[model samples]
Target: MIRDMAKGLNFPEEATAFLGECFDKITALEDGNDQLALAMDAFFASKDYASILNRLAEQTGIHRYSVDMVFLLLCADSLHDIYYIKELPEELFHNTMMDLKCKLLECKALHGIWGTFVTDWLQGYFHLKRYALGRLQYNTIEFPYEDYKGILKKGDRVLSCHIPSGAPLLIEDVLDSLKQAYAFYPDELRDGVLPITCHSWLLYAPHYEVFPEHSNLRKFYDLFTVIDNEATEGSNLDRIFNVTETDDYSTLAETTTLQKRFKKYLMDGNVMGEGFGILLFDGEKIL
Candidate 1:
């Protein structure tokens, strides 16, 4: 079942094999050690499962990433349960589950492992707090900006949009996702307005200096009414370069135009950071 789940999530063959091995080791360990068995149960049931799993990893001499993989696979076994309960579309389930694969790849790229530290974030999917409709992932969040206190107010319910790494964020695909979201969460809309919010490095205003006006990313940035921009040192480097270490810019590869431009921007002592924005979706278009 674990292996099937791995394949179904489109995990690479090497990653799938690693997950199978971890699952077998976990099964054997739990079967032989009653205390370990109890801890495994607690991991599944407890909200502080990451800490528990970290302790288990130390006790059993298994890599932390491997422990996380076993836990994720165990969670994957019941993926359909949430879908059934939420009455979410099957396509959304598949699209959302693909995030698992993306994060696994990210882990391998960043740490050379098939495990993830973002399990807490992944919990949103299993706990029914997040969903992927098309090109974007949407989750309910409190309006976090102070600029819109009168119009929207802090703590007011809003749809937080996230861009999952994969295909290009074509305008058509993004529009389709927004259209789907406006329809899917009718109860959340007020006066046919779906308040969507985003805070990401992609929204960093200085990208305008790096990205051409016609670039998909630029187009994405244009979709929002940016409210704030603040310097967050090194936030964009890892995502853009796929390398964890960011202190030394000379070692980074300049394989793409954006990378070359952004790398030069950094080498020139300029910092890149995230921006906060809101998109008012009026059921049909971004208003």
Candidate 2:
């Protein structure tokens, strides 16, 4: 089951077991103190994420923020709960599950999924975050929106046809939609370079004895194979860049496509903060 999921994330087959082992090892080390060790998890689980975050911030003297550690570990611990994809076809199920789990595990998962919910938004108005000298806007695009005969008003009426993503959404699909927006606003997207990011839930493998922060690590370093290399262009080619397996990313990270794809992340705001990076292509590449 895990192998299938790891495969979907384009993760290595071997590391799936190793990651499970890591979780088990963490669990074993926790021993009888699991509850105490996971106190932060309890706080966040009870919707006190903000309060705990504040408290942890004030305690600068403390090293090794156990609260934060527990939160992410809890995320890892719960990575396998995929009720949404359970009924999907076997071939389609694992990838879907991995995609969703990865999203849920991402550090900024909540804000990236929905806007930073706690921010003040009066009269149905809210400000979105941005990145890269305003070159990148964070999670500001609603998958379904106006100017393309979008509903214009939020209501029951559906337009643009909704589809259940039984797998991770494709970069090509994202680009297609982005182009639609580009068609509407040409001046803003001047020079054909529009950089939007896509991220997935992935617990990366070790890098120089360090894990790359264990979140969505896709810079789509391999996407050029599809976008630049015509032979690779197709329906799910974007997913070929999914770093699902642990060591899979580390190996794929070092490839002919490395320059074509970047083994990197934004200094900030590729999405909310961190742990949400997949494909954030530059304008020249797509347009």
Candidate 3:
């Protein structure tokens, strides 16, 4: 099952085999082990995932993140059952589950391992509160801004769109994802329009200074009506550069053009921050 899921998520053959080995070890360790059994139960019950994860690491002598991957694979059956009960499309489920492989790649890039630190974030998938629709991920969120309410009021149902890593945020793909969100959540639409909100560093206005006119990031930033910008202590350096730490910016790699530009931007005493924006999509297009 782990191998099948790994393949479904397009995991490399080496990663697939390693995950299978972890699964086998975990299965063998589960029988007649009361403590291990308790931890597994707690994991499935959504009780203290960190503690369960730590316990698994101690018991199995495996890296915490590798255990995390195995645990996610263990929960695959239940997640599938939830998707089935919700009657969501299989493609949607696959796209959402693809986040696992994405995060694994991120872990490999950052730490040279096949694991994830965002197991808590993955809970939304198991709970059915999030979906991946093409180039974006959407989670149901109440309109969080009260200070500048226009068409959307506080506590109103809104889809919070997130730009997941691993893809160029092309305009066409983003538009298609918005269209899918409009069709997927008929109940959440207001007057045939889907209200979407985003809060991410990509929307940070200052990034435009470094982004070229035709850069995809800049293009995506222009899609929303930004309402707020706030200073952040640290930037998304880890995400942007695939490095685990950002304390010493001098060590950051400049593999991509954006990376080179952003490194210079940071070195020149500029700060990275986040912005909040809203978009109203009227089924066919953004209104």
Candidate 4:
């Protein structure tokens, strides 16, 4: 019973419809004979990915703490479904899903200043806007504060917004600078690429900032190539570090697929690895 499934996982009554829908889809798989990997393939192959991600972000109200877990569970199900040939039983299947859900509630998705600031500010800004305004209205303006707002507003109005004591720092300022150029290019980024880029920047930016003595953003310089070809040397940090530098779609596709496959492999472990091996061996045999 999915009710048991939800109760076992401590999921709220609000998730009843959502979890029921997921369970219904999983149960619909060939009347209990379908394997886990196939079910996941079917799930991901369908519109579930966008739906679940959208729920993780908006409906579930768990973006801050539960999102990483949802992401992990998403790939986990996908990889396991792609690798495991065995059909999961109702109990185990429900249990695994519940465990994944519970695990998500415990996962730490944020890593850098973005993580810290988003937790304190972004969530607060969205959840408690009036409170944030009360705090930020009369303090010294921060870098990314002025920067990100401009991008979000699509205007270049310099803010005199003051930061209150113990206020969140302007992590979005750096993100804003990066946003200026990539305004709406990668639709995914505009949609739900927050974690990817936030994690990337969190890993890179601090070293470039406070401890310039100990870090080098240039370590990642070659990763991106300017598509314009006229990109100059040392024009600006953001432009210099643009990921869209290259004009090669193949390179971009390969890079993206490689990252996706690797992430799948990492999340799903030997399941994905063995699946790949079987695919390779089967292809060789057919050849």
RMSD of each: 2.2, 15.7, 2.0, 22.5
Query: C-alpha displacement of 170 in model 1, angstroms?
Result: 1.2
What would the per-residue lDDT of candidate 4 be over residues 1-287, giving only the tens digit for each residue? 54454455565555545445554544454532233333334344442333434333453343433333323333444434433455533333342344333322222222211001122222212111211122122111222222231222223222222222222334343233234213322332322221111112212321222222222233222222211122122222221122323333223222333334423332342111000000001111211
The numbered model that scores best in TM-score is 3
Per-residue accuracy of model 3 over 180-226 as CA lDDT, tens digit each: 88888898887677888999998888887788778888888888999
The whole-model C-alpha lDDT of candidate 2 against the native structure comes to 0.30
| TM-score head-to-head 3 vs 4, winner | 3
> What's the best-to-worst order under lDDT?
3, 1, 2, 4
Using Cα atoms with residue i matched to residue i, what is each candidate's TM-score against the true structure?
A: 0.92, 0.28, 0.93, 0.21
Candidate structures ordered by TM-score, highest first: 3, 1, 2, 4
In the predicted model 4, the residue pairs found to clash are 37-81, 139-162, 139-163, 144-173, 225-245, 225-246, 226-245, 227-245
Better of 2 and 4 by lDDT: 2
- After superposing candidate 2, which stretches have Cα over 4 Å from the reference? 1-14, 30-92, 100-147, 153-287
Judged by lDDT against the true structure, how good is candidate 1? 0.80
lDDT for residue 51 in candidate 1, whole number 0-100: 65
Error of 4 at 174 (Å): 23
Model 4 weakest lDDT span, ten residues long: 272-281
Between prediction 1 and prediction 3, the one with superior lDDT is 3
Positional deviation of 246 in candidate 2, in angstroms?
Answer: 24
Range of the 10 consecutive residues with the lowest summed lDDT in candidate 2:
122-131
| Number of the candidate with higher lDDT, 1 or 2 | 1
